[model samples]
Target: MLVSKYFKLNRSQATLDFLDIHIDKDIPVFVDPTSLRSLKTEWGHHCVSLLQNYFSCVLSAIRKGDDERAKTLLSCLNERNEFHLGYSKKKSRGHALGPASADEIWKSLSKSKAATTGLLTDLEDAVLFVDGVGPDMLSDAVCNIIRGPLIEYTQNACLYYEIPMEKEVSSGPVWNAHLERWEQSLIELPLARGAPIILIPKVVVRAKQSYNSNEYYRHYLMPVLQKHHKDTNSSLVHVLKGKKNKGEKRVYKTDLYELYGADKLASAKLTVAHPSALTNYRDAKKSTQAPPLDHTALAKLENIPNPDFPALLNEATKLRPGSKDAYLYEDAIEKFISGFLYPSLSFPVKQDGIHDGRKRIDITYVNSAKSGFFEWLSRHYAASHIFVECKNYGKEVGNPEVDQLAGRFSPSRGQVGILIARSVADKNLLLQRCKDTAADGRGFIIFLDDIDLRELIGQRYDVISGDSNHLLYKRFKALIS
Candidate 1:
């Protein structure tokens, strides 16, 4: 529904069909009717249902490029909001209120009270904080914060990414140097108010810097900038940034950016940029200066159709276009059971997904902390292993499925039928049967997509590795030797 309204597409047909397969719908989508707080896990991530809204918001901003407005919209968003977006200054009746002037707006959105406050009395009186970062040729992922939201300004003064909220902040010599160099770097830029992104191949990240600094750079700074490129997801990048200030010895570590092509970092096609540092360099009064506006792409993003929640749910069951249906959803249950709860049961997902696999599996990885596969046989099959069954349908596997697994296994190798289903409603009786049978044996209905699978395992292909033995390590380590 929100997607259709913002992107100006027909709501019913506007599916998030990114990949080729029609069954790829398991990639999380945002469901608006629900809120984030209700579904937040112990880890505080938004529920899986809200992922679609998150994508909608980000996509809306990028495609529409209402630079100033987008900055305001994105800053105020958080996991608490279920990542549900559609925030625009136009809808805020209080946006024009006078009691709170622009002076207070910037401070409110500062490192502590991070959120986009729509009212800015004097956008011209802003100072864009930055470091002397060039293209990614230097920092790699180390100083990714510096390589921010896609920019148009080049003479090195690119249109910097907006500081959403100060999820975290650090201050010190090592950190203070980067910030100082950044502030100092800002003294030379043309824009003053917004956090205009500047690039330094190596921003000189300081590990010994305050934890506040590390958290800020990692969560807010990196995530904000990285959201620009989809490939940046899952990069557990470690910094190899600039040397310390004069007193500290210059560490000579190779930055990861050197490995990237400059062509990839180029994206002037989107937003605007301005690189002229404060020409009146020595004046502290200059942080109030503003750059001329590039009035070229100021048109508000056109509205598109957002999907209706009822239809989306119905479609996932029908196994239509982009429908994960039930197969992928069920496998996610196995991953969560095996990886998080039951280490013994945890294993990588099968790319081809699961059927009632009559034979052996294609891929299997063993955890090192546990014993080997052969050891399972020695333990007399008492190991907490269960046979997995992933069903991509609306109906439950019922007592029949449970009995089928029970029939196959001997007492030494006890078996449980982990039947995964899409909607829990249809599986009601079957699930009860599994529970009742638990006393005699262990078999249960996982009812997969009843909850968001992506919120459990992931949205992409994740593989598990079993080569944990010391001998295996020595053999692999020998290659380096």
Candidate 2:
């Protein structure tokens, strides 16, 4: 069972901000540290700092010849099956660093030329130069180092979804950057089948590791060899076989690899001589942005079909307003909105609390909009966070609804929101009320009734071409005009 299904959240992978991982088997995605470093969010910055601190500590231990400390640091990375990710063939038994593997890892790093010469600057660098360290191990090591932040994210998500968590579970090996050591704490954690569960943000994961030996060998190393052989007129250069380019000849790295057996140490030696290639590779990886898994990819991993949009809309529209199951309608609306405005808005916090729990916003999405209306709102209205209020009322949404959403806004939280309701008896009056709020410097609110929502839902494909926000733009225009 997937985490969403197990928790009865009634949400699919399409609408979730995190990967809805299965409890029994591992999903074939890995957390890419490069992606985290490339993020512009506060959470992304924090995760990067944690990873750098922990990895730096390990390097310091190795450089100082403190074998015990280095080994001890490595030993913290046990099999963390809670995440339920990676390439496990069956159950989620992680192949992370255990005691034996930790010793081997320490030995490899302690004797490595890359480690001594400062070539191995980050965890991703290990995949290029270190033996027995691949994408899976690198990802596991990162998860261990940044486990604290992941735990906090999981807790916040659980609170939003009303998923129950066990109190005082062990938080394993959180890196205390200030103190330069590891620490453990007892905290609340969700459990499944007698094991702990930690949620990973979708933004920080990729289908493949950003820095891999295969890509380095092909793109970086081969190009360097090609330049070197061309400069010296080395034996590796060969003439073209086809008549299209009769006299053309080029240095082929494949022939060189055949000669040197495609060894990492040989490639590392070449990198040491011509370091610009490695620098170029790192620079490229740093700039490239890897998108999170889409709805179709998420469904494939869960062995399910794509989200039925028409069915989702039908379910939301059919629910009786103000009934005992009104919450279901709220969930349905959230699903539609989340799926509808994704990539533009993400990390939706359902029923987000404010003013120390005095009030709650129905759904709050982090403004990750790179282009289009949400991005425009961010620039003009300071909408770093987009607040949403879901009203399942059968009557017209009035001042109270607008006022409620406005109350949740502030200088830090943002001043823009979307009000989703079943119906509005007078949308122009509601828009006038919203306009009044905007005029008073309180906030800006846009109302989306079922009809408007249907329109938005129909234009969901426009999100890709940056056109899906036209409906929202129209509604927002009425508020200001």
Q: List the residue pairs that clash in candidate 2.
A: none
Task: Give the alpha carbon lDDT tens digit for every residue of 1-481 in model 2.
Answer: 8998998987777777777888888888999888777566778789899988888888889999999999998888887788888999799988778889999888888877777677878888888877778898888888888888899899988987788999989888888889978899999999988789999887677888888887897898788878888888878888787889876879876687887656566666667777888999998876675766667777777788888777777788988877565678878877877776766778787778888999998888887765667767777787998888888888878777788898999988888898888887787888789889988989888888788877776676664345645688877777787
Determine the C-alpha RMSD for candidate 2 after optimal superposition of all C-alphas.
Answer: 3.1
TM-score of each: 0.22, 0.88
Estimate every model's Cα lDDT from 0 to 1. Answer: 0.27, 0.82
Predicted model with the maximum TM-score:
2
* lDDT of each residue in 2-103, candidate 1, tens digit only: 322222332222221111011111111111111112212221132222233332342344345434544443332211111111222232111111222322
| The candidate that achieves the highest lDDT relative to the unseen native structure | 2
TM-score of 2: 0.88
Clashes of 2: 0
lDDT of 2 at 281: 95
* RMSD of each candidate relative to the true structure: 23.9, 3.1
